[model samples]
Target: MRFNRGRRSFLLGTAATFVADFVLLVPGLLSGRSVRAAGQPVSADSTVITVDSTVIDVSQGAASGALALVTGTTFNTSGTPEQGVRVRALDPATRNEFARVFSDANGQYSLNLDPGIYEIRANKSGWGAISIAVTAGAGATHIVDFGNGAPPPPPQEGTGLVTGTTFNASGTPEQGVRVRALDPATRNEFARVFSDANGQYSLDLDPGIYEIRANKSGWGATSLGVTVVAGATHTVDFGSGTAPPPPPPQETALLTGTTFNASGALEEAVRVRALDPATRDEFARVFSDANGQYSLDLDPGTYTIRANKPGWGAISMAVTVVAGEIRILDISP
Candidate 1:
């Protein structure tokens, strides 16, 4: 459903720590001869060496608009990464698809979108389609992953039809009503059709969660959640004259930081991670740029942040964020 609201831009936050240490040893003499140094080498006393530490601090603040990100890998039923799967996100208000992409050779896809809730779907030839719902608040990042963990769904069944009729508040057959059958697990549409003059609609679907809805103009009916069996015609009816209200607007927060190396220089191309404190699932990951600057916009909450680089050590810290606040942190490794 559409709501009257002003559009805003998305914001980003960065993460990093700032701490370093150094240890130096002096050479000693023995038996009036310069003690031969072992294989160990030492820098001149005048030379300064800085060793990066793994401590990070995160602060929070408000954001006007926020940049939202969705990224994850796609795998097959065999538990192997798969490529070329079509990933899609649908805008709730327009019911029109806003973003679509294919998994790369590594079976990964990423998309940047405005703050809102979306219906995500993925499918590939020889694989069963999947769907799920995700809420991407202003300046927030979320990840939705898909895989059977077993074997891919076998070939789809060729039989089964879902039939439905729609009636108006007056108990008369309603024509031109839009009907949709969805898979609740992936929040994906199995089929969509409109009612005929007789207010009858039909869709052939494989057995799964039998969720369906009907909408006409600005009014709609409550969703019917049920289960369907193969080769059966499931009959459900919609007779509501009410429209669901719009969801409340979401608040946003900001997080940002920089990454540095042992020499106290900005380090670029480091992968920074944000995880849900309770589930420990990574929700977002961004890389440092040429200047070692990074940023994120997110819904305020407690999260575990981490930074990773190949040769340097990894760092992890926990922090809480509140709406409309800015937090700055530094990381060294």
Candidate 2:
């Protein structure tokens, strides 16, 4: 699928806030000291320094120089710092990634870059990704953060939850399948998501009748209708129990013959052409060898076979070939 610049920007904005409550940025020059948020429990893998309240001062780090500094923290919906999220800096025009780093045990990362416009992305397996656009100037510092908040909360008043698993025809869980909620009356899609590794997906929607559809490439889609109620949960599953049959193998046929003159003498170096009679489009061409023998391999079809020589004139005949056939015809031209 392809998206224009405007559409790409819209999608990035929507996904950034999809589940995350909000992104926080504390941009300023901090003392070289790294400080953690008071009373926050430290994970076993956490580093000694954590930046929760202020941005890290690049001037004190190895990146100190004329290069611009980009820094941020990764956190969960509840504002708890998350470790090991991968952050990337990409060229805005070409969308080519130039730099990447993983959040430290303190859920913090810093990147130094040349002055330019960039698309910053944060991602991790199993969790959705978020991205933001930024402009970095020489000798400047910018802060950006990312996270898709926790799972959807219980349906509030006037809203309900839908959850399900997508399966293949053979009854095995199918990951990466797209699941969508559509308005029953208008048939317009309202929300969509890709199933996770375990084939699980969920959507929070307003109370109404909806068509829940599951789709994946190479497989027929499945859908179900449900009447949603406020503050309730619904479960739905998709797929047929039987598997689809395998595709047929491809096969070819061969056409071989000898060329002869009108006087019944074997003629060598005669040009043999095979063409589609209806369109007169040539498919194969070859010259008779010293022994007056030539061959053409083609798919099953009807073709116009023509043999010609400078002084021997030409002969045209309609020949039919079927799969696995080795047809032989003598041409006297």
Candidate 3:
């Protein structure tokens, strides 16, 4: 209180030094608002997403009670929001996650980002990845509705169509020609058709190697290899042009079997026929000869032998007949 001039000057000088030090460090210790790179205070903004002129009903992952707009999805997760399932602004060019958001239990997320394409990935535990594209613009409210799964993709064009006709080697429309398409390398048939009255056959097939075979009774079968390209027309013509007839006494699967009783006595006057399992259709039938031997002609197919007599029990078994091969179905009671 009674300091001299020199003492008073020292006290004033010390106070000035302390004040200067405090001012220098005040900027660091004080809590200040977030600043932009240009030193401007950051301001809060609302995120908005617009629904485009797309068919929203069938949009990807659109289902019950779900509303879907561009800003991702607004949904109800019940109780609490699933973590990691947040709203984020992605870099349109590189498609990298840039911004993030968390949805409340009512599934509300906001991404106040600039105008660009952003990806919205959900944190749906135990579920597959769910994502959507959002076009965020200034002064827009993006309310995307997400359900438990992904949205359905847009509709596509009709499946490829295959069209054509089957003609006999004589260049005439032969009705009842069963045409089949087989994969060239696998030889597995996937499509079948019948020639119309005009000997026309058509099919829509995926692009692949295929074999078109024209099958008819009495006449030899005709086949041609074809490669179907996508969106390209494949015309197959099995011109009946000058095809010779099968040689006389055309070879067929001729099966011969003897029928007899368990007592070793030959049974005669027996009615026998080959049965097809797939179609349940019966083929040719022949009676037993005097020696109890029976013969029948059939195409290469798995067949069953059925026998009937006035007093004897019927006998039958399955027989697999390969093309140009003979198979015997012995009769047993």
Candidate 4:
């Protein structure tokens, strides 16, 4: 797998906190302190493992384009325990996964994922996080570590912390609203917030100019522009667009000739769906009509026609076309 291993640049003097008052601290566990110059020692029973929380700054194709890797090492213990570590990035209404890394002799692993809320789990290490939500800006890095070790507590002095809440235009609380606060100069989404039942959210960001937007459900979303002076709180809200239109029908690739099982038998009742590649959304779904044949009229673009049968395998092929374009596809498993 292609893993983007970018060294973290900035470290948050304080350890990671999944939420308020809930620190990722274990009573007897003191894994992180200082092991800069050389590699640290790995004991058969490692309770002290250093951690690093890196804030990523990125810009590219989609919001899900910026990907990074998270990793660390533990000693070669006599009995290998499944760390049970799971890592994923958080979007407004969804959680996307990069991958899960299990410890080995070197006690190391990593995940390739984009920016957003990242929930990590280490059952064997007594570590659990709902989602270490992150809003990394392009080219910027924030370090967050949790394992056998961690950093010290946050200092009283403000390192440029800015905050605020999100609400709909009607002043109603918007849950799962995708709020992005961007730093005008760097164009980096410094801090991100989501409205609670009270239409509230907050972020710890550096002092500067920001452009915040609100995404509410059912109603048209709004973008509220504001500036976050040194250490201050700013409130903003907008109506999310009308309930997103109903999801279109599922899509299936069009089949002209015979679709067969590995044994040259006609494949029947294969589930197929037509897709709108541009949005990756489905349009319509159906069984391969009686003759083991099917047709799909996809929204002009690129599509991967898929064919599947219970006792047989599945096959898919990519087809590209312009508006009102039609293509034929066949499958054999």
Q: How many residue pairs clash in each candidate?
A: 29, 2, 29, 44
Report the C-alpha lDDT of model 3 over 211-317, residue by residue, as the tens digit: 55556675445444444455554455443442221111223455656678767787655667678767757665555533455555456677877887777778777
Sort by TM-score, best first: what order?
2, 1, 4, 3
Off by over 4 Å in 1: 1-65, 92-95, 150-333
TM-scores for all predictions: 0.29, 0.35, 0.25, 0.28
lDDT of 2 by residue, 1-333 (tens): 111221232223211211100111122211211222232322222322223332211122323455676777877545677787777777644667656666777688766666766666666775545544555667767666555333423443456777666677566766667777776445577666566444556666777656666667775455444556678876666553322211111355667767888888767667777788998787666565434555565668899988887998988999998877667788895
Which candidate has the top score in TM-score? 2
- Which of candidates 2 and 3 reaches a greater TM-score? 2
Error of 3 at 90 (Å): 49
In Å, residue 87's CA in model 3 sits off its true spot by: 53
Best by lDDT: 2
- In Å, residue 98's CA in model 3 sits off its true spot by 52
The 10-residue segment of model 4 with minimum total lDDT is 16-25
RMSD of 3: 27.8
lDDT of 1 by residue, 98-167 (tens): 6565666777766555676565666777754554445566665555555533221222244355555567
How would you encode candidate 4's per-residue C-alpha lDDT over 51-104 as one tens digit per residue?
A: 333221111112223544444432212323224333333443344333333344
lDDT of 1 at 197: 47
Judged by lDDT against the true structure, how good is candidate 3? 0.44
Question: lDDT scores for all predictions?
Answer: 0.53, 0.57, 0.44, 0.38
Order the numbered candidates by lDDT, best leading.
2, 1, 3, 4
